[model samples]
Target: MTEYMPIMLDVRDMRVLVVGGGRIAGRKARQLAEAGADITLISPEAEPEIRELEAAGTLRWLRREASEEDVDGYRIVYAASGDETLNERIAEAARRQGALVNAASRAQAGNFIHPAVLRRGRLIVTASTSGAGPSAASALIRELDERFGDEYETYAEFLYFMRKKVRETVIEPETRHRLMRKLAETDILDQIRQDTFVPWSETEAAAWIEREREE
Candidate 1:
């Protein structure tokens, strides 16, 4: 068994082919569409959501069964036809053509597995069970969703601005490290949970750092 490695792909404007028209294919198509991929779904039948996207011209629809040729000129291919034999053929074709393939029916058949991911602005958290139990992975994602609320989102944004400001204002490397250490020790999330404003300004962050050092 191959060890599953986690990675994020930049799918913007990439050509993605989804071989299926059922619910599974529709779900995959929707996700790829949301990621700004040029999705082409090949299936004889489509779910209601797929039809809506097709009608709205958000995605291209081919009312025909998938073939090896469908993998051609595509950056990524997803085989979710629910047929083991068909999915295997798709995967083989994608491999021979040097295209990345994802077989939703069998994770072992594909090179990668899609993880349950939650995104908040620049913060992205993903969970996977190596394709053993997708349901369990989904459950874990839900649990994380409940435990880590919007505070994490705000914290990520705060860090982004802080890093940029540090580059612009703090010239000394030692000074920058000191400031970052102080920010890390201040427990900004705890303060946010306690209903305090997230201090993003240099002066506010410095004050919080001083208070933490005194404690």
Candidate 2:
């Protein structure tokens, strides 16, 4: 088994290929398109959303079966065709081109697996079961989505701003570490829950730190 190195790829302006027109393929293509990838979907038939994207010019839909040439010059390829033989062919072609290939049918055939992901502003959470059960992974992701709530968005945004401020204002490494620890300990989630938008100032954060130290 190859060790997976997790990475968040910026697919913006990259060419992506989807070799199926079914619901699963459409879902994958839609996500790639949303990430600003130049998606080309090759399918003899397409779902309504795929057709919609084609009409809207968000994605290019080829009304034909995927060919080896379709995998050429693509940064990433998704083989979601119902036909296992065609999917394998697509994967093989993509591998030959040194492009990243995702086999929706067989995980071992591809180099990477797409985890169920939830995005909240700059924060993204993903759930993966190493291809053991995609449905379980999706269910876990949904559970996390419900548990984390919208307050996490505000909390994460505040942390981003806090980190930037700390970098600019505090020069000492130890002091910065202490400050960051303090920020982590503070109940920012509680603040969000209470509808407090206090801007997460250094003074407030430092006071929280002092209070924690005393306790």
Q: Kindly provide the TM-score of model 2 when superposed on the true structure, using C-alpha atoms.
A: 0.84
lDDT of 1 by residue, 117-195 (tens): 8887788999998888899999999998898888888888887777676666667787777777767665777877777
Clashing pairs in 2: none
RMSD vs true structure, all candidates:
3.7, 3.6
Provide the clash count, candidate 2. 0
lDDT of 2 at 183: 80
Steric collisions counted per model: 0, 0
Model 2: lDDT of residue 132 = 85
Query: For candidate 1, what is the total of clashing residue pairs?
Result: 0
Q: Which parts of model 1 are misplaced by more than 4 Å?
A: 167-182, 198-215
lDDT by residue for model 2 (152-172), tens: 888899888877777776677
